[model samples]
Target: MKFDLHVHTRFSKDSDADIDAIILHAKKNGLDGFAVCDHDVTGGGPFSVQRAAELGSDLVIIPGVEISTSEGHLLVLGIKESIEPGLSPAETILRARAQDAVVILPHPFKLTSHGIGYIAGLDVDAVEVLNSRCLTDGPNNKACAAATSLGIAQVGGSDCHVPEMVGISYTEIDVQERSLDAVLDAIRQGKVRPGGGKTPKVFVMRQMMKNAQKRTAKILGLD
Candidate 1:
């Protein structure tokens, strides 16, 4: 099954794409499934999953959240509840594991944000090796090396907030079923493969937007 493991919807304050729009784009692109991993929220998961079902589009929606940890970012899939940020990466992993959710280290080697290096000693289920927005090939290779050294599964995601960028990167899992649990099991069992390469234009635009948002937050005293 082809799945885009990381995507953001309007539920995230920084994104403008809605659940419906994301699903439509996925379906249009011939993807089998996608995850709605809005930052720190699951408010859009059920809505997206249900909408996909209603459309009879064969698009499986995985409930997930991209949590901002003190070290870097973590993507928790197969979750249905909110997990507050500011926790250490290890603490966050434990909490998510307690809820039977799968933990993923997102862009650990990326220089701009909290990365896997922040919680290197902690055990994690998977690591994202091919993030569509990775600034350089060097970091992507480092992430792959980390996952290999840790003996954890490696996956990929678009980390897409914009409509046009969906499916730029994805995880290919050899699973019989398309359910959330099945997907998580495949990842845990290391039955997934990553695929994607950086698009120069998209990479630059995403970074610029991130910087602008950070500056805006700082100015508003919201950072």
Candidate 2:
């Protein structure tokens, strides 16, 4: 099964992707499933799942969150509740584990995007070695190398904030079933490989600028 394990929707302060649009585009992108991992929020995941069902789409919607840990970002999958942000990465992982969640270190070397710098002792279940939002492959390469050195599972995600970019990058999982449990279990056991291509640089830049504008507007109380 092909899955984009990181995505954001309007539930995220930085995104405006509609759940309905996201489901439509995911199907168009040939993805079997994708996780709604809105930054620091957990609501988008369930909302997306419900919306998919309403649309009669069978795409698997894994509930997840891209937590803003004290060190950087961590992707916690298979969880419905939000973990408090700003905790240490170790502490955050512990909280996710308590819920039997699968934790992934996303863009671990991309300091500009809040990537957790050194992943050696993080105790994460996987490392995002292919993030489509990366302008260059340097960060992704470093993440891949680190994961390889640490014997950690490697995964990929579009890190998309919009519906159109849904499957720019994805993790191909070897699963017998297309259910959420099977997908999470596959990732936990490292039965996955990163696939797909990077998002175009122009598109990535446009999205970044849009997010910046949104933040600026909010800061000025104009949003």
Cα-lDDT of candidate 2: 0.92
Candidate 2 C-alpha lDDT tens digits along 47-160: 988989889999999999999999899999999577999999999999999999999999999999999899898888899999999999999999999899999999999999
TM-scores for all predictions? 0.89, 0.97
Candidate 1, overall lDDT? 0.81
Where does model 1 exceed 4 Å of error? 203-207, 210-223
Cα RMSDs of all predictions?
2.5, 0.9
Please report the candidate that would top lDDT against the real structure. 2
- lDDT tens per residue, model 1, 121-182: 76777788898877678878888887787777888988887766777889898899967788
Local distance difference test, per candidate? 0.81, 0.92
Off by over 4 Å in 2: none
